[model samples]
Target chain A: MSVDLRSAFFYSRKDIFKNIKIFIIITLSIILATANIIVINGLIDGMIEDLVDNTVESSVGHLNIYPDNNERFIEGIGIKEQRLATLKEVEAYSPRISATGVLSNKELSVSSTILALDPDKERKTTKLLEKLVRGAAVNPNDKNAILVSSRLAEDLKLDVGDEATLAFENGIIKVYNVKGIIRTGNLDFDSSTVIMPMDEAYRQLAIDNMASIILVKLSDKSMSEIYKPMIMQNLDVNNIRTWEEETEFVSNFANSWRSISSIISGVGLIAAAISVGIVIYINIIHKKRQIGIMKAIGTSNAFIFTVFLMEAAIFGVIGVFIGDSVGYLAIKYFEANPFLDAISQTWISARFEPQLFYIATIFSFGVTILAGVYPAIKASRVEIIKAIWGT
Target chain B: MEIIKTSNLKKSYMLGNVEVKALNGVDTSIEQGEFVAIMGPSGCGKSTFLNLTGMLDTPTSGEIYLEGKDVTNMNSNMRAEYRLKYMGFVFQFFNLFNELTVMENVMFPMMLNKRSNYKERAKELLNLVGLGDRLNHLPSELSGGQQQRVTIARSLANDPKILLADEPTGNLDTASSIEIIELFRKLNQEQGQTIVMVTHSPEIGGMTDRIIHFRDGTIEH
Candidate 1:
């Protein structure tokens, strides 16, 4: 290192400790700014992750296999099920048949979608059983039992254990007992949907070994794109979609939240930069005479500028370190005690992302150094005669 | 040998909108190992002469030579490097850095010069100034005279060829002033140190080997 930089390092390090009180106040502001950015971003990421998880669990099970465009139902579904079981990538699969019907209670009637599923298979492929808001899940043997979504039950004034009659478009009518109430936070699914047993549905609709769609759960949801093509080739089906594609409704909201999070973080960092600049500027003003004396004694302008920048860098590192620790602890606390979201009927916790913390640390440090530049230049450019003589 | 020479050295700056000539058409030279005093009244360019010679400020269209090299138009960085390598400054205010210890203040020039064993050299200089025991004390902890002593010690840290003192004893008591002048005399006679001091006191001026008088921005014969 050059003498200017070396001397600057020495002076800056010692001076920071010498002026501990003022630097402490500056550091506190930096800590708050960094922590706010981290915590706010973490919460947004957590909410988005929850949305994606709920979409995968309650509705899209990583990947979905649908019938051809011209066909109402998939042919040879039993053979397809056997083929899907042979693939190691498939964790589990459930075939479902959806039929539009009129669901009526004693006092009210509403248009609803009757979704038929194998209860035992559905439990592995989706979260329908786990999301039960009230009462027990539908039993596979009890063909007369059914699960009704909270919104549909509310529209028909129906509750668990109540009898509701469903009239399909094919002139098939059946009365069933509502076994449970589930809320997936999916507006379309929760609003007007009723779940029933596949065996009973096939008998009532006069069909066998056929399904309108097959939901496939995978070991890792991120592999959906890779596995989708493989599944399509094996089943000879042209209609297949990944979970990310199936959750367009939630993805739009997630994108908006990400943009909002960036704006909030940007504002917070700018405030921190301004605070750092003002403090360093005031410090330079107070030490104007000292700077003049240094120049008089042959200290270079480069030395003066480097000293102030080094001091600012030290402050940034200390503050960001403490802020990162605080943010991490906060996320852990939130994880231990998650919020109960009424709409999703799920617990939401903050996500702790190491990549986000690293980026925040680097960006905050860079901003702090930039903030010190003007003040350091001003210190370096002090007129020796006027500064020393106070003219 | 001429250690320093000024050929029609001039400097000017605007006081409000009017240009004030601080120095004008002055020619002089100080031989090597000479102890000279520049005596002048207030507003007579004594400090300006000292500042120009010390490379702390630039002259306006005139030439200055230190040991035969014309050094009139060096930029700020080059001037700073030349000053560090060859000159030392003692200000009237005894401007020791208040935050640093006496030892550290003395070592500052050496640190800038990138010299090794600066701690030992600073200790030796402080001891010569009779502040060996006050090494760890801050500038604020010392008396006005002691702080001036520290400044003198700091000025000699780099072993510069010329020591320039601007009213070095102006803020000191009579007893302390005599001590500082006696220290300068001892340094000049014993070590052959070259010094150029600016002062208003004839008593201090009489102690030096030669005295140059100034009036209205020019030296009086």
Candidate 2:
């Protein structure tokens, strides 16, 4: 039958508003589901951003190289002999000497991961310079100057220019001047680290002409596969790791968060579907007689279905707009509020992203429309005689 | 020429293993431009007969011919098309879409037919029904008589050949019932519109050109 599009629109709109409570409930359910989806997705994105920022800023460059024997943790009187490559092959590279040590002052002592790096090369290889909370980057030529984390400095009561004694294995001990303090907002790294020049580390540990590992930065991430094997072959090092491989813990954590968020969003979607279905079903029941009257007046079933679907589409649009606004405002509030500091300290920082908001809104609207199908069909299937006679 | 003709029409209901016959081998014909009323007591199958003729219900057995075309076994879609092109209906309750204004209610059928100038046509119909001044009023805002008048205007939206009214005045007061009957009479006399109304009120039934009394699923006269 030729259905009147305008009449269907008018009739559906009237029915929707006439039963205001159902309309409101359907819209509210859609909004809540959409908000949950947006917030969960936002949280996961924030966590990934934080993990990548922390990993890239601290020590792991885009790539890393270690001696073939470095994996066995061999204890020797001196550093292991290994062939090193020319610096010209890499965009940038930094030598690092990593070992466990104890930091001590007049009043306090703490165990920390002591990383000795060539500061000038480190600056070019990573975002280390941007993460400093106080003082300057370590001087490549200063033998006694060292940089410690803010938490370590706080624990040891050491300030810039203060002398701190570091004790290593085999009765090795060195006293160093605190040059700077750094806070990366990552508790795992910020609470237990110390940085010094590689030469200073070699002298203190009684090693000569040796470095534990080399960190390299490529011009682009896509070039990692090409450079990784070349770097290993040139340096004669079989033990190597990329940033993604070395940071399995953080990557796994982010993956788990993603999966959990998807599950939550899935549940929210199902709830939205059920809510819309129930609302449309009840609406059809309430309007059966009206539908019958329309049909008896020569309206087609297709027209009836279109009318209900249009009502659902309208609800979806309104709900998506409302949910997106609320979700964005909530994210913005979290970004501006100091109460989120606890999360930032442990996880990642939050930021506003308009793209995510739009994506969530469109997704919510699509879901609402899909959920409207069965109810519309049921409404259109109403028999005219039974409906009009209340049978 | 006959606008509606039915032969050996039968309809039955299964009420928990009890077969109740609503229409039993009923043969009837309605001529074009003729005003007729079907009168019967409660449960005498007056409504069932009207529904069958209106194409709203299917007869269990037999054939229905509209303008010499067999439509007994046609699909629901075809039935709807036939109804839209050839028939109009008014219910006992004045079944106006309560949310719509008087003009909108009148324009509904015209919209279904994809008729152009729907606004102008709706306004003209409302004026003809003496509701031009109340065109913007909702169905709930109007009196029962006024609501029925709107229903009458709605029935004429497509200018259908026949108007099948099922108890059109069943719920109205005496004065309102008389008004509706007079309107139907005018449509038949002036517009040459055929009308078949099912009513229990003998007073209203007396106004039609012919009366077919029904008893136990069969027409008596």
The number of clashing residue pairs in each candidate reads 0, 0
**How would you encode candidate 1's per-residue C-alpha lDDT over A1-391 as one tens digit per residue?**
1447778877887777787887788788778777877888788888888878877888877889988999999989989999999999999999999998989998689999989999899999998778888989877677788889999999888899999998887998889899999888888889999888898888889899999999999998899999988999999999998998988877799889888988887887788889889988988898888889888888778888888888889889998898788878888787688797877766788898998788778878888888889988999889988898888
Best by lDDT: 1
The residue pairs in collision within model 2 are none
Best by TM-score: 1
Per-residue lDDT for A281 in model 2?
A: 79
Against the hidden reference, what TM-scores do the models get?
A: 0.93, 0.88
Residue A268, candidate 1: C-alpha displacement in angstroms:
2.0
Tens digits of per-residue lDDT for model 2, A1-391: 5666787778778777876787788888888888877777776677676667667666587777665562522223132223322434467777678888998998689988888877787888877766777788887788878889988999898888899998875468888888899877668667888888878777778775556777777777557767778776665567778887777777888888889988888888788878887887787888789889988987778988898888788888888888888788777765565233454354444556777777777778888888888889988899999999989
What clash count does candidate 2 reach? 0
Off by over 4 Å in 2: A2-7, A17-25, A28-32, A70-91, A104-110, A129-138, A141-145, A150-164, A175-181, A233-236, A321-362
- The most accurate candidate by DockQ is 2
Considering the two chains of model 1, state its CAPRI-style docking category: medium
Docking class of 2: medium
Candidate 1 lDDT over B1-221, as tens digits, reads 99999989899999899999999988989998999999989989999999999888889968899999988888888888888888888888988887789999988889899899999999999999899999999999999999999998998899888999999999999999989988888878887889999988999999999999999889999
